[model samples]
Target: MQEWWRSAVIYQVYPRSYQDSDGDGIGDLAGITSRLDHIAALGVDCIWLSPIFASPQADMGYDVSDYLAVDPIFGNLAAFDTLITEAHARGLKVITDQVLSHTSDKHEWFQQSRKDRDNDKADWYVWADPLPDGSPPTNWHSHFGGPAWEFDPGRGQYYLHHFLASQPDLNYHNPDVVDAILETCKFWLDRGLDGFRLDTVNYFFHDHELRSNPPAQTRPQVMATDLYGMQKNIYNKTRPENLGFLERLRTLTNQYKDIMMVGEVGEMGNRSIEIMGEYTAGEHRLHMAYSFAMLGPDFNAEHFRNCIEGFQRGAPDGHPYWSFSNHDVPRQVSRWAEHSVSEDAMARLSCAMLMSFEGTIGIYQGEELGQTETEMEFEELTDPPAIRYWPNVKGRDGCRTPMVWEKDQPNAGFSTGKPWLPVKAPQAAKAVDQQTDDGIMAFYKEMIAYRKNSPVLSRGKTTFIDQPEPILAFTRKADAEAMTFVFNLSKDTQEIPMQAEAEIAKGNFAQIKDGTLTLEGNGYVYLSHTGKAPI
Candidate 1:
């Protein structure tokens, strides 16, 4: 089978926020199955569903208790099978989030591991002896807050947990543990899953010596609400032993024809790009990897250029998947509001910019509708991080609100009952029911189609042209086909020297005359230099 993921576009669906068929105020598999046509119509090749495995809902299904079973809230195994069949029938491959770095403390393995040190599962989790003062094993801190080590009274030691105490990090140092993890993956592949999106792929290992990480010069990807980034995390994650486990996983996936795995590199800043390269540098590793580099607050052309160029310079043969918005971060339109003329313009510009990049593309649910972050009160917050650090952190509940499908219905037609997270007026106003022919949703459809049909944009090599700030220019070429893409990532009109001029194949708010390319605020243009123009 061909590497279908090399040029595929994946639509990410946060199942809990998508639809609720059982009126339980939470989205489920049946609800997602009912909405297959909506995803198929988006012109994307694959569907990436967030974690739906049997979890205790401690961290919204990411804290898994059973890797092989579907949670009751999402549906049973039979419902998942039906969803796979429906999605495949529509020529769409299905992938699910695999949270392998940790498991819920309620899991049988963890439960047994904590019972006695002589059990078969005793070494299944990362446990260490407390320091001289009976404190945590090290100076490590959890991504949520406080110490990364949680003391278990029965075990007489501290077990490592990168997130909440409910979610305990697995011990990849044990080969038996790796074997067990691969079996769960084999079970999913046998059920006809096309691929997997590995959540926090780089977090699968830790230094066994328990060396304390040094302090950092700059905490790039942290907020003041957490102290996890106060020191550079060298010992806790990104261990060299991680490659062996990834290779073992790749070997397992290779057994099933056409199965691919895209990992989520759990890092930030330029270092994230370097890790992405290493993880996807060879065929024996991940098929592709993505990080939170582009998901942050940077909106300038230099930042975008450096990210793309850094990935290329780090690993020439590696592959990357770029995304603008997801459940964890604020929406792109709302996050970069100061750089665009309006919400609609920013949405359109983001779509055009993301599609023009060279790699597999992912768009989160409701992003096509230009959905902004839903402001939530402390009482309405359920995310563990936000609830713990209320006023300062302002948790991720705002980004994880339910998707809006109707304008005037209760809960915006997302649910007959009150949603898990309230769907306010600002979000409901951009409902699917109220979309116009030239609306943001339509532009997403157009831009996605434009990318799907263009080989240069998908399979071509990129060469960026140096320009001033807020002016991003690049050329993609494959065979006789070539195209130049330029975007004015600012609120003011700007002009640049036209490197090459062709017909405006697809895009808006730009013009070309007298060797000058003029772009209005948030303007973009697709200059096709080949006979085969964009659709």
Candidate 2:
């Protein structure tokens, strides 16, 4: 069998917002199974479910209470089995989020580990003794807010929590902890799971010596938190020991047929790209990995080029996963609004740009409709980070709102009852049922189909074409076929000289009539050109 995931188009499904079948306002497993047809119709290769494991709903299922049990609110184990069966029946691979870096504070392992020093699970989590004055072991800060350590009075020590205090970092330093996590993973594989989307994969291990991280060489302007951004984060995560564990995880996956895993390198800025390279450098680590480099608000051609080229140089042996939006970040349409002509045009451009990138691509649900982030209020917020840092940090709740299916239906046909996240006028207007042939939905379908059919798009090596700002150009060549792709990144029309004997393979707002190409705002063109790489 071929390595399907190497070039597959993945669709991400946020369980809480996709659909609700029980009329309880919350989405469940049955809801996902019922919606399989909608997903299959999109021509995607796989469906990536974001964290459905049993949890206390803290950090929205990123903190696992039980790896073996499916949360009752979502459904039982039987429902999950049916989801896998139905998804497979439609020729779609099913993968799930494996939050291995941490577990819910309520997890049996963490509970027992916190109870006493001599318990069997005492060393399962990263626990450190308080400093002389009774403070945290080191000066690490949590991603959410406050200190990364929580004082457990009973254990007389502090435990490391990279994210929320409820989500304690697992002690990969312990061989037994690694063994147990692997067993948990094996259970799913035995159940016929296609793969996993590893959450915070780099945070699996921490500094054994408990050293303080040095200050960041330059405080980046994009930092949301106060102290977390100031430090370079050398000690608390992305430890070298994590590489050995990934090899172990990869070996376990290799035992199964056609199984693939994509890890999310949790670091930001350039370092994230570096981590992705190390994590997927060879056959021994992750099959592929993604970094937040592309997820941020960098909209220019140089930023995009630097990220892809950086990864190529850093991990020539590794594969990359590309995406513009996900559950954690603000929707792309809204984040990059200033640079686009319209939401629909922005959606189309992002989709086309992502398709041209030289890596496996992922498209989040609702992106087809050009769904913008929901405008939330303080009272309506349920996200931990949003609630903690109001105004300053708008948080991620805006992007987790319910999917819109029917324009006129209550809760946009996502549920019969009031939805967990509201469907406001902005998103409801872009409902799936209301879209026409000329709408964003149809544009996305066309682009996805084209990418799938063209070998140049799926298996091409990209060479960057130098151009002025607002004009992003590149060429993808594979075997005997070569194609030129150019995207207009701003709201103003841009013109650039072109050289190639070609016909328009596909595109909009672009035409080569006089040895020069003109691209309108948010426009793109794909050319089936002859000769060497287009410049």
Candidate 3:
């Protein structure tokens, strides 16, 4: 089968916010099917839907109660079939989110497992004996805001939950659990689904010994809200066993044609890249992997360079999926506001930079429209993290706001009724209908077209140029075609001396005059060159 995903641009759709066909203040599969034209117009090759599986809505469908069934809130199996068909018709592959790491406490397997220690499904989840004093298990901490272990009086044991207490981590140590998950994957594949976006892929397994993770050498003050980050996270997740499970997943996916699996490496710093490398090292593992490395607050040349370079050095054969914004984090336009001249400039620059990178690219919904994160009051929030952390964390609700389609329509045309998340003035201002001739949207369409036309940007090898602060420069060289990409990541104008036999692309922002390249604030340029000197 062809490795189509290698250069494919994936558009991530957060179901609850994309479009709501019904007036339930939520988005559904049918709503997504209706908006397929917008995604098709953006020239994306695939659509990665966030979790829409049956759930108790504890973690917004991340807590899966039924892996094979679609949540009623997002329509049923019939609706999902229609979505797959419509997406395929638009020449776009459909990849749904697969939260394999854990399931909702309301799931039948979990219900059974928690009923009794000697039940048939007793080992279906990660259950451990409490300490002698009746305290919970080891020092493992949940990513949400509490201990990783949740006590169940019925089973008289503590169950491991990397996220919410309601979202219990499955025991991958059991072969049955692995087999069952594979079967669930097969169910979707049989339904004409292209592939899956494995959620928190690194957290699939935990140390059998139940060992406590050691403290990190240094805890960054930036992520202080997440106490889980204070530790090295050695024993809790990204265990060696994950590779075997991934291989098993790869083996299963191999049975299908052109099927791909992109695992989400939910780690930070160099370790995240390392895990991405390991998980995608070869054909036997994941087709590609992505991490939160670029989703953080750091917005500099060195940071971006390190992430791409680190992946290349760590896993030369491994593939990577890069995205600046997603459902979990704040919008890039808002997150990188300090470095941006304006939100529009940042949006255009982001597209230029992400498309020029040599890997699979992902664009979250509303990004093409230059949507900024919506500010919401405490009562307006739906995300658990935001509700718990409140003022300090402000969780993912801002980014997960409704997709604004029309400025005049109700709820920005996302829904006829009230939206689950508010569409405030800042976000509604960039509505799709209003942005027909918008610079950011036009740049996105043009840049995506440019990227698809040039194989070098997608398949070439990346070579970074050592330049001063604020300027990021790199050359992407394929067999015969080579292109140099330069960006001013800061709000200040910068000029760099470049000696190259290159012609500037017409639609690009920056220009080269008198052998000197000048980049305005948040400006970027693409240079096509057959021969090159210093870049």
lDDT minimum window of 10 residues, candidate 3: 500-509
Q: Ranking under TM-score, best-scoring first?
A: 2, 3, 1
TM-scores, all candidates, are: 0.98, 0.98, 0.98
State the TM-score for model 2.
Answer: 0.98
What would the TM-score be for candidate 3 when compared with the true structure?
0.98
Report the Cα lDDT for candidate 1: 0.91
Give the runs in model 1 whose Cα sits over 4 Å from its true position.
220-222, 530-535
User: Could you tell me which residue pairs clash in candidate 1?
Assistant: none
Model 2 over residues 418-444: C-alpha lDDT tens digits? 888888998999999989988888888
Q: For model 2, state the Cα shift of residue 196 in Å.
A: 0.4
Off by over 4 Å in 3: 220-224, 506-509
